[model samples]
Target: MDRLIYLDNAATTRTAPEVVEAMLPYFSESYGNPSSVYSFAAKNKDAVTGTRETIAKILGADTSEIYFTAGGTESDNWALKAAAEAYASKGKHIITTKIEHHAILHTGAYLEKRGYEVTYLDVDENGVVSPAAVEAAIRPDTILISVMFANNEIGTIEPIREIGQIARAHGVLFHTDAVQAFGQIPIRVDDCCIDMLSASGHKLNGPKGIGFLYIRKGVKIRSFIHGGAQERKRRAGTENVPGIIGLGAAAQRAARSMEERTAKERELRDHLIGRVLAEIPYSRLNGHPTDRLPNNANFSFRFIEGESLLIMLDMKGICASSGSACTSGSLDPSHVLLAIGLPHEIAHGSLRLTLGEETTREDIDYVVDALKEIVARLRDMSPLYEDFVKKNRQ
Candidate 1:
């Protein structure tokens, strides 16, 4: 284990060196509270404000529309809960896809417990939610529609613009969990009709404690935390000034390097997929092939368990995931895989390898060679594969 090859960028990325450097001053030298009204604290306050404007500009949103939060979970929880509470008079129903991250799914379930009716729409085998199905699910009581901009597990980019259009036509607030999509892809809130969007800093080479929620003008959702007048009185707490600055720095870097970075990633991603499918037995690709994220490649191999594969990869100094890092503890087959029509067995064998900017062609070659050996070894030990081989011989 002289070296580590990390392929789980969707879980979280290593903070960029430049972002870390940008954050250093806020920790010691400029360690003044942004909430402090003194002239001495103005630098920290200005830094926070400037970071907000930076994030807002990336989303094509107004500077005032962005509200900083602890991370993606808080932003998502705030969006769904606050929207339900704020617009309760209009309706008590919501719409979302079955393939959403647990942040969105769990919040929907909590709302259901509190008397909100939720419609969990199914996706096609490629993990694509139909905008028509979303429209069909809308009822007179439908008040909100929350969908992820991309599937965290499979990396299938969703029809955000189309769904956003549908929500707008019906006067429903649309919120997208852009935790995986932000910084990795181009998203213009105004162009896509996104009323609310959630993103995490850690997902894009920034500090883990900071994230932002974009709320369209006039959409007055209730405040998430309730102690101080931070985040324009919308979210309460002392700002993580270092985290904010780090996130801004990361956002700028991601935007500046997106085209070049993604081009290299897409080339490597395809190479990895091609080698795995061609060299391995009983392997199938997951997610939409062309429509997926440039840096993601998920696969399902017959007759082997995902946990076993992950463990073996770990032994070889490689890191990967069976699904999302959030739900890695769960024993049940992924609801997302089930939503996309995978049986429990095949879904149980899922492997998700999301690439990062630091990944190299040599890295992918190493991973592919490792997968060939691991999958072959795992399948050899399986009774299912043994039976299949005997059947073919007969």
Candidate 2:
């Protein structure tokens, strides 16, 4: 059997063997609830605290500021909801972008139902929201501004530092959904003036169902989960002991190898992009060419539906995605692509191939060759392509 090529890191990454090793102990020998008062549980409790410190160091945040949650979605929901409730008196208005993951977009909608106002800023053709646009959208009643550090679909990194500075100047809390950017890029909360940030373990080669939110010191946000004191009483409920251990180990590894890993991935990603665009006619690369994530390469193939392409890739043991994993089953075209000014037909034809630490140049070359064949085969069967060719020839 041929080696499987996994190019969907933006959806989730394979858990590192080292991370799995780190987590093994807690599932059996060290299986004690962190909240228990007995001596057996004390070790697990300390492990949770120690892991928090490890993640805190990665984000340049204090240990007290990190709050654990289920994953990125939960962290995002918590951040936006907490901010809206905390600052309701200051103003009920919130600022975000149209290209945000549904986590933020849906949360904003929920907030609006509860009497909060949300202003969604528009992005450029490359899916970049300007800090000036963010500032202009800010009203006197605006209490919080939330933007993702990087888009999950297009992979365009946002100007978070500039936006954070604007939020600071206006005395409004700034939060970024850094789930897609946290381990992939360097993020210093203090340097960026970020009040809050979100991250998930599965996005960075760690165990699933564990993530953390970084809340800057002195931020007056309310508790997300209301239960027995956990996460320093900021987030409640018993902690997932093994998952936290795995996340800490993964975070440590990612921070240590970020530069080398990303450089290699970027090279392979560029190679794939170049080959796909050159070999496949009528294909266009999406997102900012230079400002995109080191591992992501999204494209739109004219007249070919992304799902059909994905199905063909799967048969060849290749894994890719049309858009965000959370929105996989939706029939509608990607909101990110639409927000970036793509027509509905073009948006529906988008493909997202995100590289990872395990991805190799050989794997990329195989995927590109497979893609060329698949796109060509699909286009041959497409009526749109036939009509396009006939119209152009005439």
Candidate 3:
């Protein structure tokens, strides 16, 4: 059997061994509920508290400000919905970018249906939002602004600090979905003036089904979940003790090795992109060259569908994605791709390959070779390619 070359780190990461080790004991002997009064439970509660403190320190946020949630989606939904409800009297208007994760875009749409007005900001060709545009979009009724710290599909890092400053100038609440950027990049919420931030554990090599929301102290946000005293009543239900512990361990590892990991990943990612463009004809890189995630490399091959390319790569034991996996079953191109001015056909041909801690130069080379072959075969079969060639020959 061929070994799988997993490159879809932006979609989700394989849990780290250290993180898995940290979570094991909680699932067995230390399974006591954190809310219980017994000694067994007290130990679990303390662990949870310690994890929270660790996460808080990493983000440079107050310990009291972080609230655990199921994942990035939940955090996004809660932040947008809670902010709208909590500050309804101030305004019912929100601002966000068109290239945001579906978690934020869909939640904003849902709020729109519920009488809130939402302004979808456009991104430049490089998939970057203009802070000036955000400032101009602000209205007296605007109560919140949510933008992702880094684009998941194209991997373009936004000017979050500038946008946060614009939001603050307008006295509007600012929320950023940092699910892809949190552990991968150096993020200090205080330094960035980010009032709210959301992150998922699985994206950072931790267990799935656990994430956190950083709500700056004094930010008005209502409860999204009800019934339990968990998460200081901001989020309900019993704690995901094991997953949280894994997230903490992952965060700690990320904090310590961020610089080293980032440098290595960037080197490999750039090499992959350069090799693919040099080897494959009619292929172009997506997203900003320098302002992209260190681990992300997205590209578009003219004339071939992304899904077809993905399937071909998968058959070659190369694991990659056509943008968001959640939207995979749909035949439509990703919203992120389309928003960046790609035509429907070009957008449909995009591929995202995200590296991680385990990714090696050898793995990248293998995937690049596989991609060059697969794209050539797919393009040869494409009628559009034939037409393009015929026209160019004239």
The sequence of per-residue lDDT tens digits that candidate 1 reaches over residues 249-295 is 99998988999999999999999999999999889999999898889
lDDT of 2 at 289: 95
Higher-ranked by TM-score: 1 or 2: 1
lDDT per model vs. reference: 0.93, 0.92, 0.92
Clash list (residue pairs), candidate 2: none
Q: Candidate 3, residues 1-394: lDDT per residue as tens digits?
A: 3888899988899999999999999998899999999998999999999999999999998999999999999999999999999999998999999999999989988999999999999999999999999999999999999999999999999999999888887788999999999988899997788999999999989989999999999998999999988999888899999999999999999889999999999999989999999999988998998999999999998999988888888898888999987787999988888888989989989999999888999998888888888888887898989998999999
User: How good is model 3 by TM-score?
Assistant: 0.98
Off by over 4 Å in 1: none
lDDT of 2 by residue, 50-103 (tens): 999999888778898888899999999999999788888888999999999999
CA displacement after TM-score superposition, residue 344 of candidate 2 (Å): 0.6
Which residue pairs of candidate 1 clash?
Answer: none
